[model samples]
Target: MGTINELLVNIEQYRLLGYAAVFLLSFLESLAFVGTVVPGALFVVFAGSLAAKGFFDLGDLFWFAAAGAILGDGVSFRLGRRSTIYFSETNRLFKPSRLARGQEFFARYGGASVLFGRFNGLIRAVVPFVAGVAGMAAGRFYLWNVSGAVAWAASHLVAGYLLGTAWRTVEVWTTRFGALLAALVLVILGVYLLKRFFVRRGRLLLAFAGSLLGSVGEAIITNPDVRTFVAAHPRLCAFLAQRFDRQRFAGLPLTLLGVSFLYVLLLLGGVIEDLLASDPIVAVDTRLDNLLFAFREPTMVKLFLWVSQLGRGTIVVAVALTVCGILALWRRQRYILPFLVTLGGSTATALLGKVAFQRPRPAGVAVYREWSYSFPSGHAVIATALYGFVVYLLWRRTAQWGQRLNIFFAGLVLMLALGFSRLYLGVHFLSDVLGGYLLGLLWLIIGVSFAEWRRAEWGPVSAAVPFRSRAAGAVLLVGLLAFFIRTGMRALPAILPANGAAAATVTVPAAAIAEGLSRNRLPPYTESIAGDKQQPLSLVVAAGNEGALTAALRSGGWLPVEPVSFTTVARAAWQALGGGFPPVAPVAPAFWAGRPNDFGFARPLALAGGKPGREEARFWRTPLRTNGAAVYVGVAERIVGYEWGLFPRLGADLDRARDDLVRSLAGSGVVAVSRKIALSPPMTGETLAGTPFFSDGAAWFVEIRP
Candidate 1:
């Protein structure tokens, strides 16, 4: 870490080398044949990220990358203009099939193919070569080539820069949120990559599948057994054929919708059954509620409160009316009835489910008091139904597959955000939101099926509405937007007060503290995100508050772990990279009862050959208390060395670290009283990070002096 820091500090000395590296990478990434083998784009992105950290100039990096990209493409174009022999069928790098696909792409898009193809990895390498071979004018080729190179450089570099800038913030929040933010990021990235893959290869995949299925279908129909069965049951075969006919709405489309409806209906039933049976899901709900309650920030609460209001009854109804008005003006009135029914039915279902179940909203943890029952979340239901219908309407009107996909994903994101807001605000449990989604999906499929049937029966409508009617639709949309803004402003004030409320504290009698520890009134071990047991609790401390407890540890030579921030993180990295250990390095968080430890402290250790080690401890404040003092349960371990010069490697002797902490506190002369007590049987376990540890399960009970 220190070595890397020093290099970054003096990076200007190697500015020329950095630029050359960037130029070469971008050049190779765009070069035909070579581009297919090199992962230059990834390196260019990393360079941009380094620039964001001040290791290089962003402008310089951009120019070098863009220039290299342009020159590389020009060279590939020249090579193509010179000869056709190298790109034959037998050439492994430039196969005839790949070249043919490139030619097709170029023919379809013309010179703009250069611009469009720049972003697609496989196509990027081949398009320039195809452009040159087609005898395209030099002027037109460079115009598109330069435009593409500049745009590509800017986009990739900007992405990397943003990621680098957000890394510090993500790191800090990750400790607080406990993998939630990280997991969310990974999911979003994965979805984006998957979407891109399908957009690029979907047509080819569909064509391939169609051919394969057609062949199989023909063989099946030609079979002797199949012919005999068909001859015996002509009516049954006709009915089956009619059901699968793609041209009719009541056929393949309706069958698919029916299947989807049944699947969602079953899921809804399962959620209801689990609720009634008090299953493990119910247990998870309580834990999650408590976890989110502990981690709520005022800023986040306000943000989610605003998001939640998007699903308000008035807002959804107003938007629905606006959409209906637009549809009527555009001669899409056939869709209006189904659309309204979908939203209305979903809302009614949620309200009815609430009344039938009478399930109370999460108590004490809720940011705002909700008067209605929470068996099925109204916000989740409305968001799903309203946005889902809107997506369907837009998808139906869109001709381009890409635009349709974008509309679908946009609606999906909105529905998910609104549903998540309800969870974040503590207004509903997991089961409630899930049930609402399933119920909403059920209605959505019905509404879409009906709309499709209507379209099929009535034939296509080509009547274009007048300019006046279109203008009126636009006005209605603007009015709806204005009303939505007004409603949001009014709703903000109602949730503001609730955001200021503190989480309620629980107290246990002093006499019960020891017995409670033995009986596991609190969890006996640390927890992972999935609620699995991790390291056992091996230390307990009683203090008036966190301040006194930290003070005693500080006096005993234990330094509090630094809170994650850019400067602290950089400093820690520098130290670790230089093979020097910092006393107050930030520690990776461990959870207990779904919440990360409330405090962390480490005592530096000197080892053989002057190596650095530390005794690390993490403590969580339990609901249990002794007299008026807060009770804290903790796990302790020894950091033996650095793992890959970044993460701290831990020692297996959990008991030794616990003993060291007790001895340090006892010798500090601040202890009122302290004793070792058996908390659990001897056990072995691994931490959330998968570091193995063993312990005698005996814990120190330390009371701090007043």
Candidate 2:
């Protein structure tokens, strides 16, 4: 908190510099070609966030941003009016074809293009130059440009302000949630990039493989041993050749689909078998359930609930009906039956699996009660079958490979999200979702094969869909969307947890603490998100309340660590780089059971040669209390040095840190009784931060006087 105060004071002292920076970024962002490289909008949004913090005036930021943008566009327009020299076929930044496209867009929309293009990153710079080259009147151009800049500035700043307001609510879960979000983003980006590479180079690679295979085949067929084998089995060879004939519907296409169907069927069976036999997959299910439950926040809960609704029965039925109507109007009658069959088959398969397994929904971790059996997720099944078919249809109709790849990846993302939502909500296990996907894919293969055969028999679809048919399809799509919105709104309340529900607390007798520790009823060590052991619990304190515990620690020269945030983190970085460390520096989080530490404290340590160090402890308020007093489980470690001038390096002796903290508390005159008890077998381990330490596995159980 002191660091935040200092930061605010510094910002106030340099307010003019902040405004100047915002203006410069906005100005550079509006210049043609340069705008493409400048993140002007991002800077303005950050300035708005600062305004929310009360360091800058929101109104002043808006005016500066707007003025900068206006002046920048005016300069770009003037350059365009002077010459076309900058825009040539050879210039990568300002290509002739790109300018031509911008001109075409400007011609189509007139002055309105300026207003709309300001929001589009690709054309925001090009449109204004195109307008000037087309001889648009200066008065008209400035009118549109000023209006666009003002609107753009206002929208970005307001968004940033809203983000700032919500930062407090978001900060608590930022570390864990940020890691999850980053992983998801990387996976999506990798898939998209891979698809692009395939779309661009797939044919050349396939042609090369074909030539290599042809040469190998020629060599094999000419060998005397192979010729003898083929002569000995002419009928077998003929059968194999017939099955691989690509020209016939019952040949290679059917063979490939049949193999895919069998593969998916086997995978689905394996999941079911694993569940029945209680394999390692079931253990994974429990661990993931606890991990996601620990990371749950209200905002994320609501988000996943909204996404889960996309797979609901009402929404799927509405979409199916709408697509059927669309296909009927467009004269694609063959697809309607196959689509319905795929959706219906997937739904039925999910229901049957639920009945066959009779697996109960996850206990204790679910956000809301789900009465249905949980062997296979219905949401996952419907998402795969319905969305997968829709993407396939779109891919067939689209002419561009890029568009087709995009459609495929979009469908993949949606399906994966639906599956994750089920797991996050604790309504389905990992294996259940996987089983659902396999079943859905199996049915989809069958449906697509049937559709393909029908198309081969009936002939290709009509060359074009008429305008009337297209209009009718659009109206039906709009109706479907409206129905979905209304139904989802009604269902959201039922899916979310009740407002009255609170976390349940457990109380244990004080005498049982020793027994609990011995039997491992209480966790013996801190864990990572994946349930790997980190540091051992070496401190256990019983206090009448949090106030008494905090007072005792403060009296022992320990200060509470500040919460991790942008301000505190920046302050820590600055202090670390300058070779001075504060007593209340923000500590990296550690998890116990499934949740992060509830409290952290540190005392500055003097090292040899005037080096800086500290002793830190993190504690969690356990659910088990004794005799109406709160019980805290904690781990203590000494920071002996620094790593990379940022991260703290831990001392090798964990026992010394624990003993020092106990002695300090005893000397504070707040301890009623303190004793060391062996909690677990002595061991050496590494912390989550990769710092190695050894402990005697004994903990000081201190009781604070009431």
Candidate 3:
């Protein structure tokens, strides 16, 4: 295989000859006895790899392979046709058992065997012979032969082509990055398989859900208040009855029990998959961590840092005990079983998964860290069980569908947010969170089902005394609603810049950098100048005065650029629609010093055919200065006219922008000296949308003449 690959790579001049080689090899592989000794699949795959590199067209290769296969089978069929009349089952050349098996296959599958047998390597050779001896019609045999060859050739060739592409991509990425990308591909495949499993078993799974819902409906109808309400309003009761009426509710208990077992199996499957690292859980987890790391800022850090405390070990214990107290106070002896099952089972499950998988947590300074293995995240499991059980309690208490829905979604949101908190705080991978969620949900299902069954067995008890006064409940509800409303209101303004050119600022401790500018000397600046979705600041400078720096940039033909906002973005779109250069383009935030760019500048361009483009640079004035000079770091990239897409998309070419900036500065003669410095190592990374880029990690430093 190595030699073949080397040969294909070295011989681009004779790529046209690959078509003939593919045809001849595929023919020999399909021929009766010769096919057994030949590696036809290997050669066809080589052809595919060649096709990938533009040496041969895959379309022509497929046709040639298919034709060769059909012809080979046809020749085998003729030999059988001539030889059968002269020979018997006792002939030395024909093994009676092999021929009998072929006969049996032919009898069972009829002409279809000709098509299916093509995939069974050894049997494929003999099937054509057996068909000929069986006196199958020549035309019918040819039809199946042609159909099977088409499928076989196309599938094998396509598989080879894809594998070839994957191999090359892995080679390139591994050289630039590491083994992470390769592992990620496996993880992604596993996740895709998981989704497929659910989809394929959707109906079977839905039956379990239907049974659970049916049980809940029965429980509601059995309530005394619900019975009284139905009696009082017969017409309304009838309408509701008609909507839910089903005769299949008779054997629903057994169905529910069966579904509960299936849930156990599914959860077990997830655990096994995770432990084996055969699922995309690990890859998804790593990639998600990388993605979240890209967007980290002090604001988000503070938000999640606070929210994550809800799942702390001390908090979990406190909440669990508090719930036990509430259950005792409510006089619900039966409800205690489910609460215990959910809480206890979740904790145990999480512990077992962690120990079994022995997966390590992501590396970072977490809000709080625990000295334990990190497979199933305890926080995710606890939230799912605790909050999920609360959902069940609310679900049982509320008869109205509207109240039930609100309760369900609220509990769901809380659980999801708790899981996200672990992810954002860099304590857990996505897999660990998912594993914990799955485990908790599994236990929650079994516990809730058992609780319902027990509740049905115990008969109705008198309602518990009110835990709090109606006024207190009202006050609590109002307070929660008000708090959420206020939170939502404040979220937008707190993070966004108030106006263009007002750089985002953060207070730096005076003692943080002894050799650099202190907090008192640091200029207020954002991480990047706000235009074009936060262009990153790649260039930094130290100048004695702001006036000199501004004048130097102006001499270099860099005009101070506008900050991006909703109004500016809209105006730009309007200008583009009218076929003109946009005055302003919105930039997405790129973080530095835990904030966005503080300043922006640009130079206009007119390309061939009067097309419009701009070379823009953004700078963030840092808290650090050199030799008592104010230090500013900036990045430059170019945006051509918007590319038409689902929505108009901005076109960027960073390398081109960098070159343009360099040429402009050199032409202006503003710099006394300029040199390149290796700021970091060469690396390959992708944007959030998966647009890949490579960087050599060089930065240009130009000292401006005072």
**Candidate order (TM-score):** 1, 2, 3
Instruction: Give the Cα-based TM-score of candidate 2 against the true structure.
Output: 0.67
Query: What is the model-wide C-alpha lDDT for candidate 2?
Result: 0.80
TM-score of each candidate?
Answer: 0.72, 0.67, 0.44
Each candidate's root-mean-square deviation in Å? 11.9, 15.5, 19.3
lDDT of 3 by residue, 283-361 (tens): 4455456435533445556666556656766556656665566566566668887788878887887888788778777
Ranking by lDDT: 2, 1, 3
**Which numbered prediction scores highest in TM-score against the true structure?**
1
Residue pairs with colliding backbones in model 2 are none
**What TM-score does prediction 1 earn?**
0.72
Pick by lDDT: which candidate is best? 2
Record all residue pairs in model 1 with backbone atoms less than 3 Å apart, i.e. clashing. Answer: 1-574, 1-577, 2-574, 2-578
lDDT of 3: 0.63
